[model samples]
Target: MSVSKKKFNLVVLDMAGTTVADGGLVEQAFSAAAWQMGADPESMIGYVRATMGESKISVFRHLFGGDEGLAQTANAAFEAAYGERVAAGLIVPIPGAREAIERLRGEGRSVVLSTGFARVTQDAILAALGWEGLADFTLCPADAGGRGRPYPDMVLAAFLRSGAADGVQEIAVVGDTSYDMLSGARAGAGVVAGVLTGAHDKAQLVEHGASHVLGSVAELDGLLGELERSS
Candidate 1:
């Protein structure tokens, strides 16, 4: 692939399943909310998984059945349940993620996080991982300006925040979901690297146009170095 044009000084990462396994937290929270509303737990989990990468309101509506009032109530219940469990220690960064971030920063790349979760939740994950100030910038769904992943809004927002808007050619979007891959492609990012550390598999990532797929974030150090050298 176009290695020369794919060299990037900036790398944007996705939080949640990519950086941390918050899917468990999400499922737990949704189940509790659904139970409170007398809904089936299994059904709620299916609903939540389908609505991933969307807004909180959308997720609640999809999970607990879509009346605005029910959605609002469900959202509050889910968040409360999630917050309590998060406080009790459920979220943890993926293996070797910290080392990968440190290595990238040490190599002079500007790193940023672009997430579907709220800023508060993102902060909690970072804190849980003890990864304070690890990234140059962070972009949450709220900061995404009405567009979420599978769209390019959040990725582009992170790029702008990292001072890479004018140099989009030198940015790579590394994520673990097809939403991340499609988002990067739509944003015109030169390279989009998908990892198997999150929800989707290699075939899914490829189907969504991921430029490369690796086993995990830990493999990033070598692959990224190779990309730079080839560039």
Candidate 2:
């Protein structure tokens, strides 16, 4: 199932739901922040979801209405709770994530991880997955001027860092959100793949410019074949 009509030189992947299951940790952290602030815990999910692909501080600003003091407060609480949660070692790589990354690397394709997570959090996940040195490049939102998803900064940063800038036409952006798809499209990447493993539904992803949507990363292997052939 070769999806690429021409093999891509590089593939940029989103970290949270695409490379690892940090969604729970994120939700938990937000919940704690809401609780500390005496806000509705569930309501915070909607705010945080909107910040899915942005920098931590930017997300905090978005969540707390740009009040620097409140953002600082919420951020501290969120980080504290999230750090404790992660220390319990509950997060894990999504199914087929490791295999897919290994497969892509084995094929000599450069693999870059572009994510909205904080650099510290991203580094922790990379270490936990034993992928710190495996990935060709790992880019955090901070490098992209603290902008979040729907902006191409993080993806572009990874592209530049991976040396894919030379072959930007041969890069794909894969993630579980419309933000990722839109970012990829804006970046002029070869393909924008949306997965259903996160909070977004298929309709939402497609509505936002996903050229292809899969049920999960487990289905990506075959989809890539089709994508390659079609490319």
Candidate 3:
């Protein structure tokens, strides 16, 4: 499948595994959350791993059989555990991630960082990385009406809030998870790119909906350049 290139003015990037290296903190936190909720961590780990970029709350809701109260409590536990890890400096920006954002912004693009974690956890990550205002905007599921990856809501919200592109086809979405690719494709982004620094591999990413597969977020600027040249 050949994809025609177009210049994108809005860039929506996934947080963990794509731009931030959380060092498997998500699974660790999920295990703790599950145990706290009287669920077997080993039994739930597979689903947790499979839904890497989906909203944590949504994952809990599924795991808890649609019991909203249980899901909410489990999600709170997960967020607290994750936030504590972030506060402990367990997370780091992916190599050259900050530089890539700066380069895109320098080239007149608006960059928005989106994540499946809650807002509090997202803020903790930003605070840990000292990236309080690095991107034009930061988003979590709650900010986009409680939907995350595999849904177009957050991407669409970024597109609507940034006012960076005239249409969805002028937007670029990059992440490391298949869910992220699906979200981008569903949102009709011009460039639905998958990076290899996170959970899912190239095949899974492409299988879901990635238009491009990159080695890492660092390569994104080059991808955009290549697209521009082809255009």
In terms of TM-score, the best-performing candidate is 3
Q: lDDT of all the models against the reference?
A: 0.75, 0.76, 0.93
lDDT of 2: 0.76
lDDT of 3 by residue, 1-231 (tens): 222233788899999999999999999999999889998999999998889999998999999999999999999999999998998889999999999999988888889999999999998899899999999999999999989889999999998888778889989999999899999999999999999999999999999999999999999989988888888
- Number of clashing residue pairs in every model? 1, 14, 0
What is the TM-score (0 to 1) of candidate 3? 0.97
Error of 2 at 178 (Å): 1.9
Sort by lDDT, best first: 3, 2, 1
> 1-231 in candidate 2: lDDT tens per residue?
123334676788887777778656888778887899887887668767765655667777877788999987887787777767777787888888888888777766778887776777777777777887777878877777777678888777776676643566678788987788889888888778888888677897888788888777666556666766776
- Candidate 2 vs candidate 3, lDDT winner: 3
Q: Cα RMSDs of all predictions? A: 3.7, 3.5, 3.7
Where does candidate 3 have its weakest 10-residue lDDT segment? 1-10
Q: How well does each candidate superpose onto the true structure, as a TM-score?
A: 0.86, 0.88, 0.97
Q: For candidate 1, write residues 118-203 as lDDT tens digits.
A: 67766766777677798877787779785677788887777767664346767788888777888888888877899897777899
